[model samples]
Target: MPSESFVASRLTSGNRLFPTVVEVTDSAVIRRRRTLFSRSEESIHLQRIASVRIETGLIWSDLIIESTGGSDPITSHGHHKADAVRIRDLVTAAQTAHLPAATEAGPSRACPFCAETIKLTARVCRFCNREV
Candidate 1:
């Protein structure tokens, strides 16, 4: 079985279509070239498929194909999708955490000239103080 991450990477890395020479069986070899076309006009060549196999199982049959192309594109897409999901979850969790509650428990500081709240470590009021 192909790795999900590897397959996902290959599927989305801007190379939607892959082309290659395929050896379907021990004696039959065919060159398969797949191109992903945007608007059916602009086409981007993906990879050169070199081989294909039909594996029969107890329930169903599966087609296993292979290509002799660089793994960069596939790996890139997989990494990108995975990274995006991770980042999104991290942001959501951080937002839901007790941010204000933690800050409220610390010492309170205020600007002498204005009623604006400030940080204790601040040398001067960020909103109004001109000199330290």
Candidate 2:
């Protein structure tokens, strides 16, 4: 069996260091298996993988796997629990950075008499014809 450190290194490497085969079942579950240099084989179950992209190199194998599921497989430097925590943190960070913030930012304006909300750029309220 390959050492845990070796497995982790292969996984975290941005470039494809292993040949990965992803199997997607009818139920949308994904099973990812990677064989590195024919010496190490690691498998990870990713709940739902919508798509996969693989880049093969002459000398090194590069694989990138994306999942549409709620979370990704956890990789840790320590125990399994630590790996879970690390994965959760990584997922959370990715989600936080993935979302686009609202383009418009300003105080919300409501007509005093009509109780209608109006956009900051709006000259008149669509719901109630109130000049801002």
Roughly what TM-score does model 2 have, to 2 decimal places? 0.29
List per-prediction Cα lDDT, in the order shown.
0.36, 0.40
Candidates in order, TM-scores: namely 0.28, 0.29
> Best by lDDT, which number?
2
Off by over 4 Å in 2: 1-31, 34-79, 95-104, 112-117, 122-132
Which digits, one per residue and each the tens of the lDDT, describe model 2 over residues 58-122? Answer: 43333344556545532222123333333334434444455587576566677765777766677
C-alpha positional error of residue 97 in candidate 1 after TM-score superposition, expressed in Å: 12
Worst 10 residues of 2 by lDDT: 1-10
C-alpha root-mean-square deviation, each candidate: 17.4, 13.9
| lDDT of prediction 2 | 0.40
Model 2 alpha-carbon miss at residue 97, Å: 4.5
Candidate 1 lDDT over 1-132, as tens digits, reads 111111222343343545222222222222233455422211112223333334443432233434456322111122233333432233334334423555454665777777577776777788888443
Residue 40 lDDT in model 2? Answer: 33
